[model samples]
Target: AEVAPGAVHVPDWLDLETRRRLVAACREWATPRAGFRAARLPNGGVMSVRTVCLGWHWYPYKYSKTIDDVDGAPVTPFPGWLAELGQRAVSDAYGAAVEYQPDIALINHYDSAAKMGLHQDKDEASLEPVVSLSLGDACVFRFGNTEHRGRPWTDVELRSGDLFVFGGPSRLAFHGVTKTLPDHGDPDLDLSGRLNITLRVSGF
Candidate 1:
């Protein structure tokens, strides 16, 4: 479904086996040595969800090779397979051959009480479309317009294996996850929360 111009949501895009494999990879990525950790905002508040970066570590408004918020160790390198998956995602979302090479990925784990505010992803140098893949529990994804974070927004339920792509004119749109539906994940997945893997091009 085209939620907006240049924004498309493909439901059940990933199969069960693929979701399981990604979950296992996420577990490995969430370990120590510049792993999944809480992100502290400039306002001195910590984010509800824990995030792990690949390819390039991301601060509030910047991207770096090291996690300045953590031990300054270089974050995990974004795997080539993952980047290929992202390219495939873009092709599937647009129904055409797209020239996308996502070098960075933000892996976020959201618990029951986690909620993301409406914000624009404008910290990158590239205006490439953001590829978001959902796993585990379902969540309410608020897709807002580019003007602001006010009204005229659409709330879409994003479940496991769903793919959402927003780019082109909507590359800087304000969007977020309002809340997650706990215990709504596939029983076979055996996950406690939701996992969102967002792929982007750093252009660095």
Candidate 2:
């Protein structure tokens, strides 16, 4: 998602060792501590079950069939190395020697068929840039204009180890994952589907 300086891609910010460790940790933490269940949407539909990790297990706005609170999941605290990586991303993008350390690392898991619709990240009080890292299979990222929902969208291919940052004017832009291309992942990564780690400043 392009906010001010347009969509800029950060290449391979995560080293092999760090990425491996992070992925391993996530795998161990995948269990739904809050009891995974389908979530009911405002439209009365349901979304897939998501296991969230806040400081503790407390994800989903409510457990029905579909959960509308995609942002309700626990903000996975970024690992020290990951936090350092995020700090660099912020400094490079904003270019003001900012010390924007992330408090919440929202980890999103997408199976083979699961998909994400266009939506904005409006739960946080801060409008700081969001740093998202993609791992596993490749996925199509649809970034739309901040003012409107559809049209004038830019679809970018997010591959393993790819980094995306969105802030400033395009911070509130509508974006979503169209789909994940199966079997397009790095074998060395050992991840099957799509795992997205988005680092953000939650509380202002």
Candidate 3:
């Protein structure tokens, strides 16, 4: 469904086996070397969700190769398979195939109490389409306009295996997850929270 201009949501995009494999890979990425950690904002506030990154370590408002806020370890490399998946997603959503070499993967874990504020992803230098994949539980995804983070927003229920892509005019639109529904995850996945994996081009 086209949520807005340049924004599309594809439901049940990932199959059962693909989701299982991605989940397993996520677990490995959440290891001690480059594990999930809460993001501390410049305002001395900590974000509700815990996140792990690949290819580039995302700070409050910048991208880097090392996690200075955490153990300062190098982030895991972005996998080629993920880039291919992202390319397929863009093609599926926009009905065209583009050269999408996503260099960053931000994996966020949202528990039942975790909620992300409405914000625009403008830290990256590239304006390539943002490819997001949902796993585990369902959530209310708030997609707002590019003007501001105020009203005139649409809330969509993003379930496990759903895919959302935003680019072009909507690339800088404000979007966030309001609330995650616990116990609504697929029992086959055996995950307690919602996992959101977003692929982006760092333009580094």
Candidate 4:
């Protein structure tokens, strides 16, 4: 349970072996379920996209559709392990037995060419913190303030097996990835890109 004190970095939460396994699993998941579209900007321009979500696609940062997995329900609901992890993260951050059960784990994939602009994760019904895990290549994460998306920001290096948690006043903070640092993962992981799994309680 490592809290990102103003976007602090937690090295090796998953360790090398676990990180490798997670990367492989993510690649396997991204194969068939590709075609993650670029988000349309407000000016009618489309932002380049390499992200693929396991659940519904939030196009233009809005929930577009509900995906079914053979059955007619959502494909990737919250996993028990992930929810437990979220609880632990919250507890570790505040030193309290806070309950955080995240139902949506947005799996965002980023290639060398992919980068995210400043945005806030306010789509969830719960104001609880967001537990984000990084796998694959390392990237520079830019975290901004809650009111405005301008400067007075922190540049955090999100490497494989790193965890970032933001809540409270920082819950509505603006954040995005500036760039992915080149060749910053285990060679055996075959990480030509990066994957970010941010767990949240969408439905409250």
After superposing candidate 2, which stretches have Cα over 4 Å from the reference? 1-6, 32-39, 48-51, 55-81, 94-96
Question: Which regions of candidate 4 are displaced past 4 Å?
Answer: 1-8, 31-37, 64-74
1-204, model 3: which lDDT tens digit per residue? 999999999999999998999999999999987898999999999999999999999999999898888877887989999999999999999998788899999999999999999999999999999999999999999999889889999999999999999999999999999999987897779688999999999988
| For model 3, the run of ten residues with the poorest summed lDDT | 183-192
lDDT of 2 by residue, 134-160 (tens): 888888889898887889888888888
The candidate maximizing lDDT is 3
| Candidate 4 root-mean-square deviation in Å | 3.6
TM-score, predicted candidate 1 vs. hidden true structure: 0.98
Q: What would the per-residue lDDT of candidate 1 be over residues 51-86, giving only the tens digit for each residue?
A: 999999988989999888888888888998998889
lDDT string, candidate 4, 38-87, tens digits: 55666887665455555454555455345421223344443466578768
TM-score versus the correct structure, for each prediction: 0.98, 0.80, 0.98, 0.81
Any idea how many clashes model 4 has?
Answer: 0
Q: How much is the lDDT of residue 143 in candidate 3?
A: 95
